[model samples]
Target chain A: MTAALMDGTAVARRSLDDTRTRVSAYRETTGRTPRLATVLVGDDPASHTYVRMKVNRCRQVGIDSLRRDLPAESTTAQVVATVDELVADESVDGILVQHPMPGHIDERAVFDAISRGKDVDGVTANAFLDMANGHEETFASCTPAGIVALLDAYDVPLSGKHVVVIGRSSILGKPAALMLLGRDATVTICHSKTRGLAQFVSEADIVVAAVGRPELIRGEWIKPGAVVIDAGYNEGNVGDVAFGPAAERARLITPVPGGVGPMTIAMLLAQTVSAAEQRES
Target chain B: MTAALMDGTAVARRSLDDTRTRVSAYRETTGRTPRLATVLVGDDPASHTYVRMKVNRCRQVGIDSLRRDLPAESTTAQVVATVDELVADESVDGILVQHPMPGHIDERAVFDAISRGKDVDGVTANAFLDMANGHEETFASCTPAGIVALLDAYDVPLSGKHVVVIGRSSILGKPAALMLLGRDATVTICHSKTRGLAQFVSEADIVVAAVGRPELIRGEWIKPGAVVIDAGYNEGNVGDVAFGPAAERARLITPVPGGVGPMTIAMLLAQTVSAAEQRES
Candidate 1:
C-alpha cells in the first residue's frame, strides 16, 4: 500500500484561518492589530524571499508587520542592539530574525538577545531547554513544533514508537527528537558522526530525516511499515530521504515541498497570535 | 573469560589526589583555597549525609566549604533568593544544592537562579542546552561527565557505537546521551514511557542504566558482550540493571556502589578546581 501523504499546505491553511480569527478578536479588544517585527540581514536571495513571504502572510492574518533590513556588513553588536530595541518596544508582540545572517556574525548571540517573550521563532537556547525539559512555559522552534503538529493532526501516535531522527541540527533534528521524547517515543538521534545509519533506520518504527543531504536515506533502509517525515529542503527542494523508495516502504510519508515547509510558517503565525494573547493577558 | 569490573572507588581516589595537587597550586598562587557553597533545605537524612560527605571531600582536596542550612518551611522564592546570593558572591567558586529539596519548592527555578558560570553541578537549563547542542562552553552534569571520564580511562572507543541510555533524567540519562553523541556514538535515550525497553537494550553496543529503578533492567535485556555502565543508585545501593546476570553476559560492567557513585563526587571536585582556575583566568 502506498503511504498516505501529510498535507502541509492544507494544515497551514487551517492554521492561518484560526490565526485570522484570533487576530480579529485581539484587534477588537485592544483597538490595535498584533505587531510582529521581522529582521532580515544580508541580501541572500532565499532569505529575502522567505522574509517577504512571512511579511505578506502577516498581512493576510491581520497582524501588523515591522521590517528591519540590515546590510551584510552589519556588526554583531549592531544586530543585537536592533533586536534589543524591538524587545523593548511595547507594540511589538513577536520578533523573528531570518536565518543565515552572515558567516562572521555570531547568530546565537543575536538570537539570545531577542526577549523570550517575543521570541516567536524560538531560536534561543533557553527556549530549546524549556522544550527539552518539558517545562510548560516554552516556545519551541517553529519547524519542529510544526512537525509535531502535523504528526498529531494525522493521528499518528508517538507513544512507544521507535523514532530514529537522522540529523541533529538545532532547528530540526535536535528539537524534533526532544519533541518526540516528550510524546513518549523511544528516540534515537543520529548525525554526521553516527555509525551504522542504515541499521538504525531499518529498526525504527518512525524515521524523521532532516540531515539536508538529498536522497541520503535510501528507501531500502527504512522499515517496511515505518512512518516517514522528511523535513529536509535541500537543492531543488529535495529531502534527505530518497522519497520514491521511502514512500513505497513507509506507512505514511510527508513529501518535501508539500510537507514540513508550509507547516513551519503556519506555526510562526500561530505562535505570533499566542504571543499576542499572552502579552495582553 | 569474565568481564573486567569498572572500579569507581579506585578511580575516584586517583581523581581526588589529582584535585588535591591542583588545589595546592591554586592556593599557593592565589592565596585562597577554592570554595564551594553547599545548600541544603529541610532535613532529609540521606541528603544531609550526602552533603556532609561532599563537604568532607572538599576539605580533603584543600578546598574550603561553606554550608547553608534552611528550614523545611522555606518558600520557593526564599530558596531562589538564597541561590541568587550565592550566584552573586565572588567568594563562592561553585554551588551545590542538595536535591529533593521539599515538594513545595520549585527545584527547577532555584537551579536556574544559580549563575551558569558557577553552576559546577551543571544542573541549570543553560548547561543542559549547551551539552545537547554540542557547544563547548558549558559545564556537564557531574555524574554524566564522570561516566565519560570513566569510559575514557578504560580506553573504550564510543565512536560509531550504539549507546543506549536507559533513563531520561536531566542529570544522568539525558546528559550522558548528549556526551556520547558528542563522541560520535549513535545515542538512543529511553525512559518509563518507552516501549520494548529490553529490545532497545538488547541491540546496544553500550548500555547506561540511570533510571533508579531497582533491577528493572533484566540480565537478558542486555546485548551479549555489550559494555554496561550502571549509573543507578536505588535503595540498598541496588542498580537499575540486575547485576548478577548482566555481569555474566556483558564484556565489561560496573558494580552498583562501586560503579558510578564514587565518580560523582570525584567529578564535583575536578569541576570545582576547574571553576577556580577559570575565575583566576
Candidate 2:
C-alpha cells in the first residue's frame, strides 16, 4: 500500500498564514514592523540561496529583514562583531547566522556571540540549553522545530513510540531527538560510528533521516508501516531516505523539497514574529 | 556466571589522589589555595549531608571551602542574590548551588547566576550548552562526568556500542547520553514514559540506570555480558537495578553505595580544582 504524504507544504502554508496575521497585528499596534537580521558569510551559492529564501519569507509575513554579507576570508572576530552589531541594534527583533561559515572561523564562538534574547534562528548555546530543559518560551533550531511541527500537523502520537534519528549534528539530529524525547517518545540517536545501523532502524516506530547522505537509509530497513520524516536535502533533490521505496512501505512520509524545507522557513518567520511580540509586550 | 564489580570507590580514590596533587601544586605556585563555595538554600537533611561531604572532600584536597545556607522560606531573588555574590567573588574559583532547592525558589535562575567560569557543578545553561557541543574545557555535570570516568577506568569500548540510558534528567541522564554519544556510542534514552522498557534494556551493550526508582531495572532485562552503571541513590541503600540478581547475569556492574556516589564527589573535586587552576593561570 502506498503511504499517505505528510504534506509539509500545506502545513507550512497554514503556519505562515498565522505568522502573517501576527506580524500585521504587531505592526498595526506598535506602528513598527518586526525586523530580522541575517548574517551570511562567504559566497557559497547554496547558503546565499537559503538566506534569500528566508528574507523573502520575512517580507511575505510583513517582517523587515536586513543582511550582513562578509568575505569568505573573514576572521571569527569579524563574524562575531557583525552578530554583536545585530545584537545591539534596538530595531532588530531576531538574529540569524547562516551555518558552515568557513573552516578557519570558529562557528561556536560566533554562535555564542548572538545575544540569547535575539537568537531567532536558535544557534546559540543558550538556546540549545533552554530547549534541552524543555523551555517553551525559547526558540528552537528551525529544522528540528519544523520536523516536530510536521509530526504534530499529521496527528502522530509520539508518547512511548520508539524514534531512531540517524544523525547527531548539534543543530539537526541532536535537537530533533531531544524534542521527540520531550514529547515522550523513546529516542535513539545513531551516527556514522553506530554499529549495525540497519538493526536499530528496524526497531523504530518513527525514523528521522537527517544524516545528509543521499539515500543512506534504505527503504527495506524501515519497519513496515512506520512513519518516516526525511529531513535531508542532498544533490539533485534526493533525500537520505530512498523515498520511492520508503513511501511504499511507510504509513506516512514527508517528501524532500516541499517537506522539511518550507516548514523550516515558516518556523523561522513565526519565531521572529514571536520574538518581536515578546520584546514589545 | 557472576559479574565483576565496577568498584567506583577505588576509581574515585585514584581520581581524588590526582586532584590532591593538582591542588597542592597550585597552592605552592600561587601561595593561595583553590576555593569552592557551596550555596545550600534549604535545611534539607539530605542536602546538608551531601554539602558537608563535598566540603570535607575539599579540605582533604587542600582546597578552601565556604558555605551560604539560606532559609527554606527564602525567595528566588534571595537565593539568586547569594549566587550572584559567589559569581563576583574573585577568591571563589568554583561555585555549587545544591539541587532541589525549596520548590518556591527558581532553580534555573539561581543556576544561571553562577558565572560560567566558576560553575564547577555545571548546572548553568552555558555549561550544559558547552558540554552538548563537546567542549571538553567546560565542566560537565558531576554525576554524568563521573559515569564517563567510571567507563574509562574499566576500559569499556564505547565506540559503536549500543548504550541504553534509563532517564532524561538535565544533569544526570541527558548529559550522560550526550557524553557517551560524543564518544561514538549509539545512545537510546528511555524514561518513565517509555513503553517496552525491557526490550530496550535487553538490547543494550551498556546500560545506565539513572531513574531513581529502586530495582526498576530487573536482572532478566540485562543482556549477557553487558556493562551496567547504576547512578540511582534511593531509599534503603538500594539502587535502580536489582543488583543481587543483575550481578548474576551482567559482565560488570556497579554496586549502590560504593559505586556512583563516590565518583560523583571525586568529579566535583577534580572540576573545582581545574577551575581554580584555570583562574590562577
Candidate 3:
C-alpha cells in the first residue's frame, strides 16, 4: 500500500496515559477520584461487553465507575428517572448511556435528560450545541471527539480543507460534521438520498465514512493524497471503505478494528475528568 | 429574466394568515388570547426596530405581546433571570430574544435558560437537536425555518436533490443545512474556508447562499435549471449571488429585499401559536 496506516490504537493509548496522569493528579488534589455513572437499559450482549470494557478502563485510570443495568422491558420513564438520579448525584462526574435501547423506550428523551455538567458521553443536545457553536467549555460527543483527537495527533490540518462526511447519525456523523465545521473545514454531509455521492467523495481532501454499510465507499471514489477515516465497524471486522484498495489511493487511512473504536472510550474518560475539573472550579 | 421569481412576501403573508386562523380558533375555544414574550437586551436601534415589527405582527395576528426591553448594561445573569420569569408565566406561550447582545453578555447562557416549551425562536439547544434529528414536534429557528417554508410553499422537491448551502453561521447556515437534511436532501455546507466555492455551487440542484458577502456567488457558476435562495441581505439591496446573471440561469430565485427577509417574523408568530396549541392540548 502506498498509504501509511493511521495508528489510532497507539494514539488512543497515549491519550489514555495522559488522562491517567491527570486523573491521578486530580484525585491527589481533590481527595477523591472522578466517577462515571454508566446506565445500560437492556441486556444486549454487545452493549454489556462495551460497558464492561469502559468500566474496567475507568478503574485502571484511577477513576471510579458506577454501573446501572435496567431490564430490556424497562419503560422510558424508568430510564429517564435513572439518569435524572445520576444527574442529581453529587459524586458522579459523568454519565454514559449505552445506546440502542429497547425500541419501546424513548431514547431521545433519555439522552435529553443527561445534564450538561455530567454528559461525558456528550450525547445531550446542550453539549452538541456548545461544541458546534465553538464555546470554549464544551464537551464533545465521544466518537466525534475521538475522530478529531486522532486527526490532531496525526497533524492533519483542518482549517480550509474539504472534508466530506458520509452518514447523518445523531451521535456520530452529524456531530462530527458540526465539530469539523467549527474548526473551519468546509463540510458536506451526504446520506441515502444524495445523488452523485462518489463524485462528492472524490473531491474531498479528507473523507470520513461513517455510514454503517460495509465497503460502501470504493477505492476509486477516494481522492489520491486524501486522509480517510472509516468510522463504521460492521460484521466481520469490516469498515465502510474497502481498505486494501482505498489505502492505495489514500495518503493516510485508519483501519476499522484498531482505529475509531478505541478512541471512543479514551474520549469518554478524558471528558469525564474534564467535567470533574469544571465542577471543582 | 428567464427564471420564475419566488415571492417571499406573498408566501409569508399566507403563513401569517394560517397562523392567524389558528390563533383566532384557539382564542374562541379557550377564551384567552395566545401571547408571545419578546426579550430585547441592549438598545441597538436595529434590534428595537425588529422587535417592534414582530410585536406589531403579533398584534395583526390577534396575539398579545409582552415586550421586555432591558437596558444595554444588563448582565447575562440578569437577562437569564428575566427569561426564567417568562418561562414560569403560563400566559406567555412563546419567547423571542433579539440577537447580537452586548459583547459583555454571555448570549448562549441566556439562550440555554429559555425553556423548550416557549422557545418560539428555536434558539435553544434542545430545539436544535429536535429539528436536526427529525423529531415530530420542533420549533425551528426563524430564518432557517423561513427558508424551508419558502421552498415548500413553492413546491420545490428536496428528496434526492443536491443542495449546496454557503455560509456556516450557527443559527442560519448550519441549521438550514440540517433542516434540509432532515427532509432527505443531500446538503453541503460551504464556508469562507471552502476551496473552489464556485465549483461546489455549480454542482447543486438547489443552492442556498447565506454567506452575507454581496455577489460572491457568480451567475456563470450557477447550474442551469437550479433553484436558488439568496439569504444574504447586504448593503444597497445586493444579495450574495450576482442575481441578474444567476436569474438568467436558475429555474427559480428569491429576490433580496422581498425574499428570505420577511419570512422570519412570520415563522416566529406561527411557531408561537404552535406552542400555544401544544400547551392547550
- Highest DockQ scorer: 2
DockQ score for candidate 3: 0.80
Which ranges of candidate 2 are over 4 A from the true structure? A71-78, B73-75
Q: Which stretches of candidate 1 lie over 4 Å from their true place?
A: none
Output the TM-score of candidate 2: 0.96
Structural similarity of chain A in candidate 3, as TM-score: 0.97
lDDT of 1 by residue, A1-281 (tens): 48889898898899999999999999999888898899988999999999999999999999999999999999999999999999999999999999988998999889989888899898887798888877647688999999999999899999988999998876788889988888889999998888788899999998999998999999999898889999988989898999998988899899889999899988998899899999889
Tens-digit lDDT string for candidate 2 (A151-217): 9999999999999999999889999999999899999999999999999999999999999999999
Chain A TM-score of each model, in the order shown?
A: 0.97, 0.96, 0.97
Cα lDDT of model 1 by residue, B125-164, tens digit: 7788888877867678999989998888788889989999
The true-versus-predicted C-alpha distance at residue A11 of model 2, in Å, is 1.8
Please give, as one word, the docking class of candidate 2.
high
Give each model's whole-structure lDDT. Answer: 0.90, 0.91, 0.92
Provide all candidates' interface root-mean-square deviations.
Answer: 1.4, 0.9, 1.0
- Lowest summed-lDDT stretch of 10 residues in model 1 chain A? A129-138
Checking candidate 2 for backbone clashes, the offending pairs are: none
